[model samples]
Target: PMYFFLANFSFLEICYASTTLPRMLMNLGTQRRRISLVACATQMCFVLMFGVAECLLLAVMAYDRYVAICNPLNYPLVMNHRVCIQLVTGSWTTGIPFLIEYTYQIFSLSFCGSNQINHFFCDVFPILKLACGDTFVNEMLAYMVAVLFGMVPFLLILGSYSKLISIILKLPSVTSQAKAFSTCSSHLMVVILFFGSAIITYLRPNTRHSEGTGKVLSLFYTILTPMFNPMIYSLRN
Candidate 1:
C-alpha cells in the first residue's frame, strides 16, 4: 500500500512539475514572458488541480502509514485494492469542481491595466493583483480555498502522524520502533517541505516586499519538492 501510494504521488509530482516548469523554462530561454489570458487560465487550472490533488494524496499516504503501523492486522483488509483506488480517485477528483469555479471567478474579472504578472507563474494572488477591479472578494475566496484544501489536508496528515508516533513509541523493541519510523520518515520530510512552502505561499499576506519572497517559496513546492520526492523515497529503499 505504501509503494502504491508512493507511485501515484510520483506520477502526481510529474504532472505538477510539468504544469509550470516547461513554460517557465521556455520563457527563460526565449525571453518571451508574455502569456495569453486563455493560456494563463489553463495553467492556473492544472496548477490548482495537481496542487490540490497532491495535498489530498499526501494526507492519504499518511493515513496509509497510520493504518499499517497502528493496525497491522487490519492494514490489508482496510487498505484493499478497491479502497486504495477509491482513495486515489477521491484525491484526484475532490477539488475539481471548486477549482474550476475559482479559476473562472479569477479570469472573469476585468484586467484593464498592465497585464504583467508579478510572479513567474499565473498563481492566484499574482493574477488577482493584475485585475483592475476590486479584488476583495477574490482574495477572501482564495484564503478560504487555501484553508480548505491546503491547511485541512495538512491537519489531517498531522493527526495521522501523531497517532503513528504514539503507536511507534509503544512498540516493545528499539528495532521495531526504528522500522516503524523508517516507513514514515521519507513521507514526513516530504509533507514538511511541500506543505510548509505551500502554507507560506498561499496563507500569508501578499505584499510588495513579499511578492519576491513568495515566488522563491513557490519554487519549493512547485519545482524543488517534486524534484526531491523520488530521491527521498529511493534513498529510503
Candidate 2:
C-alpha cells in the first residue's frame, strides 16, 4: 500500500515537473516559447501545491520512521488506519492553501517584458523576478512562503532527527549504531539537499549566488532529489 501511495506521489511529481520544465526545455531548444498567462498561473499552482504536499509527506514519512524504530511494538497501533487518513488529509490541507497564496501572488503580478523564466517550472522566485510592475506584494508573499513551506518543515525534520540520533546512540553495540545511521543518512541527505537549496535561494542573507547556481541548486531538490531517494535508500541499506 505504501509502495502504491509513493508511486502515485511520484507520478504526480513527474506530471507537475513536466508542466513547467518541459516548456522550459522546449524554449531552450527552439529559443522562443511563451506561456499563456492562464497556463503560467495553472503551472505555478500545481508546482507549488505538489511541492508542498511532497514536503508534508516527507515529514510524515519521518514520523513513521520515528514510530517504527523507536517503538516497533506499538507501530501498528500508533499509525492505525484512521490515523493514516488524518495524516494524508493534513498534508493536502496544508498544501492547498499555500497553492492559493502562490497563485494569487502570481496572477497579481504584471508581466510586460520577456516572460522567459531561466529555471525549469514557474517557481515563485524566478517568476517574481520577471514581474514588470511593483512586486512588493509578491515578494512579501514569497517571504511568507519561505517561512511556512521552507523553514518550518525543515525545522521539524531537524528536530525529529535530533531525537532519532539520541535514540540511535543509546543502542548497545557499534554495529547496531552503524546500521541505524546508514538507514538514516540517506533521509538526512535528502532533507539537507531540499532545505539547503530552498534556504539559500529564498532565505538568503547575501544575494551572491549567480543565476547558474540558482538553477543548478534548485534542480538538485526539485528534479534530482526525488529520483535519488529510492536509489540512495536501497544502496545504503
Candidate 3:
C-alpha cells in the first residue's frame, strides 16, 4: 500500500516537472522566447497547481511515515485503502482553486512595464513585477495563498517529523536507530530541498539575494528538486 502511494507520488513529480521544466529549458535555448498571454497564464496555473500538489503530497507522505513509525501495530488500520485514496485525491485536487486564484490575480494586473519576465518562466513574483498599477492587492493575495499552501503543509511536515524523531529516539537498539534514521533522513533531505527552496522563493524578503539568486532557487524547487526526488527516495531507501 505504501509502495502504491510512493508510486503515485513519483507520478506526480513527473507531471510537476513536465509542467515547467521542459518549457524553461527550451526558452533558455531558443531565441524566440516569447510566450503568449494565454500560454503564460496557462503555464502559471499548471505550475502553481502542480507545485501545491507536490507540497501536499509530501505532507501526506510524512503522515504515512509517522503512522508507520509511531503506530506500527495499527498502520494497516489507520492507513487503509480508502484513506490512501482520499489522501491522494485531496492532494491532487486541492490546488485547483489556487490555480484559478493565482492565474486570475496575475493576469488581472496591467503589464504596462516590460512584458519580459525576469525569470526563465512565468512565475508569480516575476510576473508581479511587470504590473504597472498598485500591486498591493495582488501581493497580498499571493502571500495569503502562499501561507495556505506552503506554510501549512510545511508545519505539518515538521510536526510529523518531530513526533517521528521522538519515537525513533526511544528505540533501544543501535541497528534499529540507524535503520530508522536512514529512512527518515532521505525524506527529510528532500523535504528540506523542496520546502527550503520554496520558502526562499516565495516567503523570503526580496532583499535577501539578487534576482539571479531568486531564479536559481526557483529552478531548484520547480525543476531540480522534482527531478531528483525519485532518485533520492530510490537511492536512500
The TM-score measured for candidate 1 stands at 0.99
* lDDT for position 219 in model 2: 83
Clashes of each: 0, 0, 0
Question: Best candidate, lDDT-wise?
Answer: 1
TM-scores, all candidates, are 0.99, 0.85, 0.95
Model 2 segments more than 4 A misplaced? 1-9, 205-209
RMSD of each: 0.7, 2.7, 1.5
lDDT for model 2: 0.73
lDDT of 3: 0.85
Predicted candidate 1 versus true structure: per-residue lDDT over 1-237, tens digit per residue:
888888899999999999999999999999999888899999999999999999999999999999999999998999999999999999999999999999999999998998899888999999998899999999999999899999999999999999999989999999999999999999999999999999999998878899999999999999999999899999999
All candidates in order of TM-score, best leading: 1, 3, 2
Evaluated at residue 4, the lDDT of candidate 1 is 86
TM-score of 2: 0.85
Ranking by lDDT: 1, 3, 2
lDDT of each: 0.94, 0.73, 0.85
Q: lDDT by residue for model 2 over 118-157, one digit each (tens)?
A: 7666677778778888887777877777778767787788
